[model samples]
Target: MSVDFGQIRRNEHLPARIAAQIGSDIQEGRLKPGDKLPTEHFLAKSLGVSRSVVREAIAQLRNEGLVETRQGVGAFVTERQSRTIRIDEGELFKRDSFRDLFQLRIPLEIEAAGLAAVHYKEADLERIDEALARMTGSEKWTDEGIDADLAFHRAIAEATGNDYFALFIGFIAERISLAIAAARARVELEEIVNVTIDEHVVVRNAIASRNPKAAREAMRAHLLGAASRVDLTLETY
Candidate 1:
């Protein structure tokens, strides 16, 4: 059962284009969770791109939480949206909507941060680092950077070694992207970008040091900071 990927058009961002096509396949249910992806070699040949391009595209998909790769096994579609709450776009634009999303996330993600600090494997740390690098290097308010920011949080969720944590956070993050993008659009301050980078660094460093308490606090503070920047408040939950 080989996947017949269409040939890619010539583009400056080949990997992104390839990733979009594969992501579309997953979204459309042409690919389902646990379904194995075509081998990099096969995808490269069929798509008329280098293996490196395919590899990068796969990495991008992984960051987007649309796919996962095993140590010796190949890539597979991730479990996403199987039990997701449907978010309404009109509600997502409401002034308080982002805060509502964060309120639900804070407890779960705080626990996830602590658990990740205690349970994270070396590869999990590497994935987190890679996502952080992408966010830090990206242009402020760009979709690519926002994707990386979301990826950073999803990596933390995965590091908890709980599949449900990853699955839930991945689904939630996808929905919240609409709000984050809208919030970013209204910002006039460039300092927001630098602050975000520093905040992520704090969380990353705490997790890397294996300090569960510090990781939890850092994660909470970061999320709180994000809410503050967006003019949202976190009430007692």
Candidate 2:
């Protein structure tokens, strides 16, 4: 049998069809907030779907918080839904998917730390030490913690003397913030930051000691430790 993508959409079962049309209507602003949807029967007839299908589609929208239903009145549109969607060649923004971003972070960060150990200058070490001090006095480990934490990592990346890898660090900062925000508590944040600082110091010390292998090892330990602490589903990757 032949297949047509457009026909497939047109022939989709009732619930999916209703969902697509309503979703499209909302997308096109034909369905504005406070707009009452037609009754289930009307929708079913109009869309050539069973009333159950209409109800199911409405339920789906309700679950998405795009519509509100009164006890005996009707379903009305709500504000348009928003999703975590953006494309910056390289930039960080608050988002809902940090796990995916962390997948890109730990290894890149650890590797950058190792490189920093090899290539960092006295000035670089001083800069990193200053950033580290900022972490030492921090109280709550929330957004402030995330800022300090990413800053420390960025410092290591800068110490690496590689600009592109540092760009990778910039890419995931916001995503890491999401996971960091979901952490155990403020103290937990401080603890992780402290632990990371220790790891970073070890890496830096190894580099300063001119032990490249030890620097790499220390960097790896820091990231893997972070993975375990964060329960990063992406640690294995």
Candidate 3:
């Protein structure tokens, strides 16, 4: 039997419940990155809700940056949260069962990126763009490049309507910075830096279109790719 969390209704909160379901799936490893979710009709049927409700729920998850839906490919798990990421001296060291952390973070970042695409106030965009510009301007390496990179992510988190996301992401900033450093060092790809700006642009465009699914997908790709770098670097460790 399929599971559902669709009882949340008027005088209720379907979106939150839906978010919880998706979030739980990631945490439990029931869903992996790039794994497609049940279709709207299937989800609606499983959850005992109208297709509109399912879509709304999916949009909420997309807004949270957890799942991405293709135009006709249904919804896929773009990213998942990690359980632990203790960064020290610019390295992303993983703790036990670290999968949980990514599981938690994916949805949040995706939502932030998506919202940034839409609600990213001009000032916020300018702030991020400035950070990007600074990153590009630096031909020489400065440890502070990490700060610029993080600032860009913070901008996306801030763009989300939910203040909690910004707060949560801020709490994890130190470790995330370390992770970024480690990943960048491993990939050694300048495009990672350059593409950040481009990927952000893709995410921004999706949100601007109010295409939550698209926004989530873009965010997911960026993050999962980040995770892949971690995998690559781990080989040397």
Candidate 4:
């Protein structure tokens, strides 16, 4: 039976709602394992939601281990009982997802920052600097600023001289993008924007100076500040 996307109403929780419907489809075998889901654009149009909403819904499924995404191809249901690992809804942007996402980043990124201090190349420094410049020059709390923020962290991950580190951080960043967007919406924008830039500058400077310990500490401090801004308590996570 064809899914009637038109019946889905628009609401604040649209992405979660969409994810639930698709999840129900998967569970019922209407969308069997290995079946390719509709294109993001098609799903967006059909559901009367933006492409980002569709993307987020798909990302949610991916986190749940209910779906797999192949580059240049669409998402497909994961083979039944094949998921060895899965992130539940609480680990997403729902209640404490941001906290969980930040916790996931702490160890990995702290290590990356240290490695970047030890191993970063001139080109890596340039990319990081460029991202920082973009953040400093862009409007506070805008989507562009958020992109630049993610880019700065990604540059540090790349500087680790490990393909796996960059790849892993990139994956985590994609999953957390919506969480970051939501966090950005809840705070005093202008204040947080300037503060975030300053925090980044500290991290960048430590990396530039080739101080591994300092870089690690700076990165830790930066992330802690971010968590505080979002009202996410990371101590327990």
Index of the highest-lDDT prediction = 4
- TM-scores, in order shown? 0.65, 0.52, 0.52, 0.64
Where does the lowest 10-residue lDDT sum fall in candidate 4? 1-10
lDDT of 4 by residue, 1-237 (tens): 111112212212555668878988987899998999999999999999878668767865775678999999889999889743444433463544545676888889899999999999999999999989988885344665666777788899999999777866765765455555555565567777888889999999999999999999999998887766655667633
RMSD of each: 9.0, 17.9, 18.0, 7.8
Ranking by TM-score: 1, 4, 2, 3
**At residue 131, what lDDT does model 4 achieve?**
88
CA shift at 64, candidate 4, in angstroms? Answer: 12
Candidate 1: residue pairs that collide: none
- Model 2, 124-196: lDDT tens digits are 7877776566656653243344455556666777788987666566545433443444443323445666676
Candidate numbers, best lDDT first, in rank order: 4, 1, 2, 3
Pull out the clashing pairs in model 4. none
lDDT of 3 at 234: 20
User: Over the stretch 54-155, how does candidate 1's per-residue lDDT look in tens digits?
Assistant: 876786577567788898889999898632343543454455664577688888888999999999999999999998998777444465666677778889
